[model samples]
Target: MFLTHGMNESGELVSVADVKSGHTNLHCPFCSEKLIARKGAIKEHHFAHAGETCMESKSTIQQTGLPFYDIATGIGKSDIKLLDKFQRYDNVWLSQKQAETAMYLTQGGLLEPSPNKPEKYQLTRLGRDLVKHHDSLLQKKIILPEATLQEQLFPARLAMLQYHDEMNGTQAARFYQLRLQALLNQHLYVLKIHLQQGSTCFPLIKVGITSRSELALRISEIKRDLQQHGEVLSIEIAGLYRHFGSLERLIHKRFRASQFVIGSHTEYFHAIETAHDLSLLNLEALGKRTVEGAYCRTTYREHAHKVRVGQRKAKLLNNTHLGRPAKNAENLLTDHPDIVEAFHASLSLRKANTKTGKAINTVRKVYAALKESGNT
Candidate 1:
């Protein structure tokens, strides 16, 4: 992401690049955490938190106006209702897994857990205070969309779909197919491409958004257009956003002042220079992958999710690990003498006794380090 705000020598707010070359006390305006100025070849210069997670980061994410915030406020809304509403309104959505993870992170006090009602978690004082503080820092107008009475009372039907239930191969495939179809039918998407030909001058990026139904046709049109001018190097569907027009406008506004604009077409920007800027708008670009890779991963996740549910239900039945950490080398060595003996036999018993002893010690050290996540 392009650095939106940063601090300088005098602790004054400034753009990231405006910081003095030798200045080392720069900090993020949002979190007041130390910021690193990254000017890598592939990515744009930006301010990243020194720590792994930052409250500012969460506050900054655009959530597409999902009602999970309502859920965060202790409202009694089912996961199914939220999912359906998002789909129906074509609002940006948080996957059930993602929402659950967020709730887990704040459960103790940041978020008040409802042990009596698992689905109804509340925001504790800390959570409410943080929300209030963040709101004070960044105020916005909220415009609730108009909906029918059925939509307002849709929570009652939340239990209609068993999407979260465990499934077999066939069930998972069917679910994936239906879910993918529903997703495509519900929202539009933005497809980004690096339009270049070896014979052409320089590569330019094109960002276009279209309904999922029109995605194929849009791609074909783009290909024909590019073929008329130059060859198409590659196309990457950067993100899938429910409000495509709004997202497109935001992206365009972000790169409007970029210095790398194409001479022929103002809409196009230098692919390499403007990549990070483009990426920042594509929130779903996390863990970018080819289309096929994404499909395979989704399928794998379906299978894995089912297996996990089964394991959790029958804890005593899974003997695969024998209740030990599956990858713990020390436990494996202790339980299976043959593996240790094989390592011993590999090092000659007579001529290489000292080397064998060292190997054994090294193995122990390696296993210990693996478990403790430390270097000895």
Candidate 2:
């Protein structure tokens, strides 16, 4: 939740003894100050700053507005948490990324953009109003029908879920569903992709979100974009994993100061609950894109994933500009203990395969050297 920011290990969030001292403590959700001094007291998970140096603060809850905690608990405790209450989709775990997609998909006009930091997002007035009227949004138990294999595909379905959730009313939902229905009706073979006969074969892509109404109105437009690129192999159901409860997640999601809809992954279910938007992103290009003249022909395939793995994390952390690694393993161990712990943890997770294991093991040697430095 709190990273010391600049890290000996890139993509690692190191906790500091004095987060406030580091000037990186996230503001307490209730009071808009980064001053939750740990007084070693109960019932004070985050209380107002009371020290002589503390800034005056108050709880952020409002009768009309929902707090981040309320939204998190609401979805986590709901029947559709992680795995379905009645059990759906192979007891799958909703990663942080999957959770995030649901939250963003359910919002109205997307959240308000901050002038101070436009890229960072927060909730909009319309989004808050939709949250206030939750009773109306939950009045549906229907998953619209699909006609083709592409429609039945996972990622496309997830995108459609995001699309349908944005529809404000029943008429809107029906209208959006029809767009998909029409997509299948108009195109023969549903979708087609021919392997180009060439030596170099590389692909590139672009991804964006739109409302069902927009999807419906721009059906021809979407087709045109895909056509210009190459074969539209998918436009299929990719992130079906988290589409079920997206509306609930969207209305309750909170990112940045008070924004929603940060995760780009199709199945960012866990990301929604904790609001962790850390993602793997390309170093050169910030968004999803392919060069105009890629290696050969490029096919546009869209899959909805809840989280962006691997590179997305590196890209997000790169923005923080954490300083370089320690001069030596000995230097690192002596200077940064928290970072060493993170390296060890990252290695231990069964999540690491052989390749990542090697990188992690190398990280540990640095930790050992740091320890050796400390002992000496």
Among all candidates shown, the one with the greatest TM-score:
1
Scored by Cα lDDT, where does model 1 land?
A: 0.42
Ten contiguous residues with the weakest lDDT in model 2 = 184-193
- Give the poorly placed runs of model 2, Cα more than 4 Å off: 1-357, 365-376
Per model, how many backbone clashes are there? 0, 44
Q: What is the lDDT for 101 in model 1?
A: 39
Model 1 ranges off by over 4 Å = 1-201, 228-233, 236-245, 259-267, 278-282, 285-376
Cα lDDT computed for each candidate against the true fold: 0.42, 0.30
Highest lDDT against the true fold, candidate: 1
Cα lDDT tens digits, model 2, 1-376, are 1111122123222222223332344443223344433423222122233233212111112111111212332222231232221122323344576445444433323243445665434444433333333334452222111111112222223333445445432132232233222221221111111211244222212222222322333335445544553443434221211111112222223222333221222211223323222222111111121212101111222222213343456659774333344276656565555555554565442233343443554555665674576632
What lDDT, from 0 to 1, does candidate 2 have?
0.30
